[model samples]
Target: MKNLLLIFFIITLIACNQSVNKISLDIRVDGMSCSHSCAPFIKRKLIKTEGVLEAEVSYEKKLAEIVFNSSAISKEEIVKKIESIADGIYKASIIKASTKETNLKKPSSLNNRESLDFNLTKPGISHSSGFQLPNLFSLLNSILK
Candidate 1:
């Protein structure tokens, strides 16, 4: 009975990890003269993608916001999808990608607000602020020396 329960628990964990999770992405799309050529087309293409759940393109802002299922596709595939269409008229680069929990109560008007959710899972040397600043006092001491 204990062995059966353990097997069930392991299966549940694997299923959760393999679930079709949704992720939101912010992309800076270049190479389009939004006024004359490509914003609407790009938005349409993204919406038509197999795993894309939602897409919002802003011509004036040069931003392509997308929500997609990660299990069905990857971020690299999304970038490639844009570059492969329309003689390569649109080029997209990711600015941010996140899997933040969706807020059911938040108003639609506040959906696209900026956030600073940084993931620290990779192997690297990290500082408190993630960057170093010059010490003004050290500079003054050097001048005196």
Candidate 2:
């Protein structure tokens, strides 16, 4: 009976840790209009954070979903990073972080998505025409400070 109890406890701990990996937030951004221009900066910042395994930013939905190791990080820190990255261009806040999965894609496959369209010649943020990421990042950084 003691052995069974120990096994259950171990399993419970693992399960709890696993649940900590998934996080999502809804960010209110001022300058974000499309995916191409704004997403890469946000993605870069989130993925570089210690525990984050995956980070997805949606311009249309104005949301950022991040998957990370709970043991190495916390929801509060993630929120701070989002706010920092978004800076003056965007305002970020935690909508909620639950065991429920918000984003289903893995980080390795992010490049394959149809949303990344920095090569286009569009002037604004929209569905068909992507924004200019490099320029936008500079603009956003300037605005942030």
Candidate 3:
């Protein structure tokens, strides 16, 4: 009975470690032209990848958000997998990466899909290349005068 109890404890520890090693990655994928074909194709490929828990690909946003176990695969390997798809036609760049500890005590529900919050750029920040719309309009008005 004592040996059985020890084995149960070991198994529980391993299960907890597996859930703690999960990482979420957001990648920006370029070269996808349409939502119908490119998006679904990438999604399917990502789902087939080993260690990937969830993959959401959006052609309109040109982004691929993936969750996987770090123990099974590295972030670089995931990026390489995306780039290698379609004979290397796609280019993938990491936008954001985060580590999340999944709660294993409660059963995960299929209807409960957690959303990732990403701030791709700083708030109230804008960059311009020495060209302003108001300046262009003023120049046009002056020329007309």
Order of candidate numbers by TM-score, starting with the best: 3, 1, 2
Q: Considering summed lDDT, which 10 consecutive residues are worst modelled in model 2?
A: 128-137
lDDT of 2 at 55: 73
Top-TM-score structure, candidate number: 3
In the range 6-95, model 3's lDDT, one tens digit per residue, is 965765554444332569888999999888899778877876676676777879889988877686679999999999999999999999
- Please identify model 1 stretches exceeding 4 Å from their true place: 1-18, 101-145
Candidates in order have lDDT scores of 0.67, 0.59, 0.68
* TM-score, cand. 1 vs. native: 0.55
- Please give the lDDT score for candidate 2: 0.59
Give one digit per residue, the lDDT tens place, for model 2 in 50-130.
Answer: 666567777877777776656567888877777676445657777767655565455443532233434433567444311
Q: For all the candidates, what are their Cα RMSDs to the real structure?
A: 19.5, 15.4, 24.0
lDDT of 1: 0.67
Best prediction by lDDT:
3
TM-score of each candidate structure, all chains considered together: 0.55, 0.52, 0.58
